[model samples]
Target: MLSESSRPIIESTLQTIAERINDITVIFYRKMFEYHPELMDGMFSRADQAEGIQPRALAGSVPVFASYILANPDSYPDEMLARIAHKHASLGVTADQYEIVYKYLFAAIAENLGDACTPEIAEAWTEVYWLMADVLVKIEKGLYDGQKNDVIHSNFKLVSRKEAGTSVLDMIFEPADSTVMSDAVAGQYVTVIVKTEDGLRQPRQYTLLPSAQNQRRIAVKQNEDGEVSPMLHKLEVGDIIEISNPYGDVVLGGYSDQDSQPLYLFSAGIGIVPMVAFLAELKKNHSKRSVVAVHADSSSEAWPLREEYLKLVAELDDAKAISFLKDGEGDFQGEVRVESLDMPRLASVYMCGPLSYMQSVRSALVQQGIPGRNIQYEIFGPDQWILRATRRSMRGNRV
Candidate 1:
């Protein structure tokens, strides 16, 4: 909750701060990285920093959070906070790091705002920052406590590697030590940490695919321009790597309580990773719910886990699968035509793909009278969904 004394101050200056938030964040990252260059080695992504995506995400989130708290002072944004906390837990973020971030973030704000940032304004913003930071710290602590082991990363030896689809490698790994492995739920992800040739450690998160209890499986799409995926693709069968415990809020069976509701799973290209896991879990449980699996790709040959995806759906009595291929044989051609599908408006939808693809599909669903709350999405990298949604809402209000 925001302090009563600071609420009016924040309300008065929020527009001014919001206008310069992007500039403030850019300065903040520059000053922080200049002072502590080691953060780039493992914790933060240099590519995202260079592209300015990280700063934009931070800039968008602070004002959104402030607005939310102002409107509803008794509660925080649980979904947004959980998503952030899960990602932080996967990367082993510590409470002390929040202090380091505060030092540079406020310094940037002071530097940018100049004479307009009075002592009272700075104090109010400080309270807001700490309030948000404290909530994240608490949530991350709970996630860490729920893990099977106290360590952030554990050694895993590669057991097998096979090509699942075009440019996608299916790798299986087993614990190299006696570290207890947590039971991973479907749709969760694990962070893989590897050392580059330059002796710098880089961490990347990959969704955990279905496998045996003692084995961990992940399908990695080799990104030619990525810092980590290329190295992951070159690993031999007997190689060792570090992996974090599985952590994600999106799961196969826990999103809603309506067990008999129609379930729709949508994916595109390498986004089929989590959809496959969800199908495998449902097959294992013999779920009788009405299930529709939809996928889109450039070609049927380019779809990762195509056969396995269809096979699982085939085994289920009340399930069916469809594909939309741009240049090859499928049930439909071109991009996903969500309007043409015969799905119930009340069905639960889980979508994973590129952000633009998901946004288009979501718009189609909304036009068909489907409730926005019924749809859930997972982003593979830094999430800008909330920021984008906030912009959309602001635009709608103006109209």
Candidate 2:
């Protein structure tokens, strides 16, 4: 909890801080990268940086955390903090790195705040920063300890590579060393680090599909101008790359794999990754739970792991798969109309995909008498949609 002295100051200046947080974040990144060129090499995504996704996420998260801590005198944002920690752990973020971040971040705050800033305000914000950082450090450490091996960078040899769909490569990998693979739960992801042709190692997180303990499968969507995925596509069966331990907490069936309630898995574009992962887990257990797998893509051919998902969904005892495509062939034509689904009562909904798509689906679900708390969403990148949805709901405003 923030000190009593800091509360009024934060409340008084929160609007200004929120208004200028973006500038602070952007400047923080630019200056941080300017000073620490090494972070740009592999630890950070140059693409995300250039696109300003990272900055916006940082900007959004800071004020959100502050507001939450300020409003709730005792509680912390566990889900948000866990997601952030998992993402950092995927990138091999260390506790010491927080020092580097704090230094540049404080400078950015001070520079942006200017005349409004005072030592007391700075000290209070600094306390908030460290509080968040300290918690993340502990969470990340726990995650690292739970893994089979503590190796942040381990070699995974490509066992096979095949086309899953248009512009998608289904790459299978096995341990290139003696390290044993830990059985990662469904909906978990691993960070694949590829050494680009430019001699920079870049890491990108991909969700795991159900596979043997000794093997891992990840479908990579080719980016025409991607720094890493394109290079990864060129590698053959015998080639090797670095992969992190499977880590992500968006799990299904951890406690009640046998639950008979309806489990709605929704996806858009590559958001199908986690859906497939969950489906694989359910299938492996021969789950009798009712499943509705909904997906949307540009076309049938453009859908990654379409055949695999179709087969798996069919294999389930009580599961129906639906697809909507703008230019689809055979079945699954036109855009998705969420209101049209035969709504299930007391359903456990999980969603991933484009922010707009999830937001629309979630809104539709909530209107159809589905509890807002029942809907769970996972973002492929920094989480923006959830916060927006949550805030809108909390304020009792129409979206």
Candidate 3:
């Protein structure tokens, strides 16, 4: 909770701070990187920074956190904090790094606000920053403590690679060292670090694909212009790479209390990775729960892991698979039309895809009488969806 004196000060300055957040974040990154260039080599993505995605995400989150606290002073945003902590833990973020971020972030705020950044205003915003940071640090510590080992990363040797779809490579790997591997739940992800030709190591997170107990598998969607994916596509079977332990909160079978509730798994393009893992887990358990697996792609041939997806659904006792293809044979001829389907009551839903696609599906589901709390989603990159939703809710509540 914010101190009594700081609370009023934050309420007074939050609007001004929100208005200038984008500029503040832009300056913060520029100054931080200029002073500590080594952070760019592995800890941060140069591409996201250059494209301004990282800055915008930060700009969105701070104000949202402040606004939510003012509106509900008794509670913190646990869901948002948990999502962030999981990502931070996977990237090996430490408690000391928050102090470094605080220094640059506030300096940038002061620079952007100029004469308006009074001592009281600065102190209040500082309180907000640490309040959020402290919760994240605690959650990250818990995540680290639950791991099988204390190390941030482990070595994995590529065992085999094969084409799964149009531009996707399904690579399998085994532990290259004696490091203990934690059992990963369905719908979790791991960060893969690759050393580029420029002698710089870069990290990118990928969802763990379903595989045997002794092996780790991931499907890489080759981005010709991407710095990490293209390099990952060229690796040989004997090559070794660094991989982090799996960490994510969007696990299958965790949302609902009833084990018999119907489950809906929705995806688009490469977003099918996590959904496939969920289906495999259900099949392994021989679950009797009703299941609906839906996917959308440009064409039938463009879908990654299509055969495996269909086979898993078929092997289940009460599951069905549906596909919507724009240019090839499928159950539907165009994009997903959620209203056309007969959704079961009390169903739990999980969606992974582009932001626009998931947003549309979620809105349609809500309109069809599905409770908003029943649906959960995973974003492939820096989270922009939560920020958008928070802003929307705040706006609606304003007079």
Candidate 4:
């Protein structure tokens, strides 16, 4: 535990470290592509990287992590951790890869900070990185250990594939061996690993759609631009996919145990996956908690789980669905446009989807004076926001 006397200094040191990390992340990617040409294969989106979004997001995340540690240690922002873990887990990033990232990160820091990179500062930052890496390594190990001990990886066999709707697939994974499939919380996800022709394994995640509890299944919306998604879409029945045990933090347990509070779930496109899962669990448990589900897509056709969401809504008196787009058609109902949504009675607002959509929703919520604690979000990739937010808070305190 960090002592009260050491808290301020540690916080200050962490702030500096966050600044340095922002520098390191930018340079690390440049060096990675230069030295590790093979790693670019399926590991990064070239177009997105070229657009400078993912890189900038990663650079910003270091500071957000520092902020979370100093400002909100109790919760530790599960949303941020879940997002990064999902991305890393999807790629099957190992403890070894974390070390690689740390190496490149520190090296770039030393290079960028130059005269400012005093030995003392470098050591302090390295200690912080190691501490963080150790924690992440342990968490990741727990996931791996669960898969190994429970043999969740061996249980799933692809039984069939059907076109749920344009590019979306309903994949059934039946137990091949006697391994009992672990019952997953509806909104949790599983890491699906596919062995490529080059013998390198690439992993992706899909939202486990609600189906018969006895059989494990998932709904995957294939991304043509994505390497893993396209390959996943191509798999035929009887094919095998290596899946890790279900893992995710975006769940609905908070309301189930407590008195019913007005819960609002906001999702866009594929972000609806976890929400669907949560609704399923709530229905199965027969919890009468009030939930308002609002989903937005580019069009009605792009919405991933339209039928299932409707079915769940029909069964539950407290559940409702609000669609923002219909087959490329834009908003019409005008009942709190995705950009305009802000409700005070909402006990918890869980958001998932693209960065822009999440950002827009977050901004609108903030404008409505919704406390950060009341807003939970799930992002799509590595966390740079966590570090950035922390640094901003630190700067405010200093001022």
Candidate 3 has a TM-score of 0.96
Candidate 3 yields a Cα-based lDDT of 0.87
Model 2 residue 394 CA deviation in Å: 4.9
What ranking emerges by lDDT with the best candidate at the front? Answer: 3, 1, 2, 4
The local distance difference test score of each candidate is 0.87, 0.82, 0.87, 0.66
lDDT of each residue in 1-399, candidate 1, tens digit only: 899999999888888888888899889998998998887776777667778876777656777778778777787877778888888888889999999889999999999989888999999999999889999999999999998889888999999999988999999999999999988999999989889988888888889999988889999999899888999999999999999999998886564324667899999988999999999988888788889999999997788988889999999868999899999599999999998997788889999988889989999999888898788888888787966664444443321
Ranking by TM-score: 3, 1, 2, 4
- Which stretch of 10 consecutive residues in model 4 shows the poorest summed lDDT? 330-339
Q: Show model 3 residue runs off by greater than 4 Å.
A: 255-260, 393-399
The estimated TM-scores of all candidates read 0.95, 0.94, 0.96, 0.79
Question: Highest TM-score, which number?
Answer: 3
Cα displacement (Å) at residue 7, model 1: 1.3
Question: What's the TM for model 1?
Answer: 0.95
Tell me the RMSD of model 2 versus the true structure: 2.4
Off by over 4 Å in 1: 255-258, 390-399
